[model samples]
Target: MIKLPSAFRTLLGWLPALAVLVFAGMALAQSFQTQIYDPTTRKWVDYTPRAAAKFYNRHGQSPEEFRRQVVPFRTAEKPGTIIIDGDRHFLYLVQPNFQAIRYGIGVGRDGFGWAGIVKIGRMQEWPTWTPPPEMIARDPESAKWANGMPGGPDNPLGARAMYLYVGNKDSIYRIHGTNQPWTIGLNISSGCIRLNNEDVSDLYSRVEVGAKVIVLMQGAALYKGV
Candidate 1:
């Protein structure tokens, strides 16, 4: 047995409680760090995409539901059409034989949600990011990139981008890859649809310019039997 002075024994007895308090404090700090006050919304919002990505990278990938997979999907839309069920955070590339390649996606938050039929106007690899005028006015941070941000791993539009168009006009929205893969399955983007880098690359390769895209927003009629 090891013997210690009275003071040392007392200190040793308090170690477990100290450890619990330390861990609790750490958890509380992390929670606070993950949220931000939104003046426009007058609420605190979860703003932890970067942090979440780091955590998931250390722990594991995003939820199993968000992983890419092939599933039985029945839709009247022809093969090569892209159907996005934003409410469910799933994007399906319609295939022949009542099948589809499904990928988890991050969709528009609250006021930004929309549903419409569009076509792929163009595609780019490692696409540059040019913050829209409205985005710059809304977010000072975006103002720095008003001119443009060159494409790379750190760019928000991770590995690829497919621009959307309504007839001959640009909708200013895109189906793109995201640097923060942890955002998949969450409602977080301004208006664009986001997929993980690997998944986006796979989708980009399969989709062609001028392919039809149907976006179903929340409460919209989702395809049956998906």
Candidate 2:
């Protein structure tokens, strides 16, 4: 075998490292392309579908900053608990080791904001929209949906909904997905805490029925970074 030059040997040594990095990058690209699963259709889906993409594009929205992520958070809640800071427009799923998965959310409008401790009484995939009696009274246009609106892409409750309850009593508030993703990070819902369709689907897969949910009002302490 011929002796290799020092520079050639050095380059050869780096080939393995370079190969590792190339493979790592490929893996990341694959993960980035496929976002999460959609419970509505029981299929894996992209981060943004056409309608959602078009809506966001029309509103000049950039969703990168608001995407869900796991972050270090200081919270007294247990691992399985869900905590919503309405004022901060964030929801935290407490995890072990003082860390939590956080998602940007759309909260109740000014007068509809609320604070309470409740449990996820139930969950629905592609949940139907039933305009409560009071809702119909408030918005007469909702009367068309008096019976119920079947869940679909245009449905107000995007893909999944977690019904909140206070000891068997329906709170009538939901932790659900919104078709209008631009409303996230703002107070604009009718008393529900809403996340993006993909975010809610990811959350629905992680949380089980009866999970503890705490919604904090104005004066409540916010989750500080760890």
Candidate 3:
């Protein structure tokens, strides 16, 4: 047995309490960092670590529902076709065996939603974002980026972007990664389909230019076979 001086023994007894206090302080600081100001709501929203962790697995990746997975999906579309079910917030890449690789997504809000068949006209990695003229008019803050916002972690397009087109013309819509991972499974974008950075990167690698993309907007029936 080890014996210590009276004062030293008292100090040792307080060690566990001190550790608890230190960890509590760290958690409090992290909670504060999650506070974000929302221009639309005109309020500050806070996301507790526990809430964020619920969406993630022990590996720090999205949970099973949000992570990319192969699931039984019956569709007549050929393999390599992309089908987006806006209401369900799911993007499915059709496979040959009546299965598809499904990834969680964030779709457009309300009136911005649209259903159509389009093709992936182009793709880019860490692409720059140039808010269109209409967006600038609707959002004064976007005017500053009329030229273009350089691609980076902070950019709205987190990692990769696939541009959609109608025949020869750009549809002005995209399927891209979002810096705001929490937005997945929500309806909040202008018209783009947003995926978490990791999932989007995976999708970007699997999909190719000229791939068929069918978007089924909220409340709309599944397109044809899809």
The per-model lDDT (C-alpha) reads 0.78, 0.75, 0.76
| lDDT at residue 7 of model 2 (Cα atoms) | 100
* Highest-scoring model, TM-score: 1
Comparison by TM-score, 2 against 3, better one: 3
lDDT of 1 by residue, 1-226 (tens): 8879999998686675445334432332111113445577899766456645754686577656678889999789999999998777899999999999999898875555566788999999999999978778889998888889999999999999999887765666799998888888776887799999999999999999999999877433222112
Per-residue lDDT tens digits for candidate 2, residues 68-121, read 989899878789899987766789999999999999887765456666678999
* TM-score per candidate: 0.72, 0.69, 0.70
Query: Higher lDDT: candidate 2 or 3?
Result: 3
Model 2 residue 114 lDDT score: 65
Candidate with better TM-score, 1 vs 3: 1
- The ten-residue window of minimal lDDT in model 1 covers 24-33
- Please report the TM-score between candidate 2 and the true structure: 0.69
* Residue pairs with backbone overlap in model 2: none
Number of the predicted model whose lDDT against the real structure is largest: 1
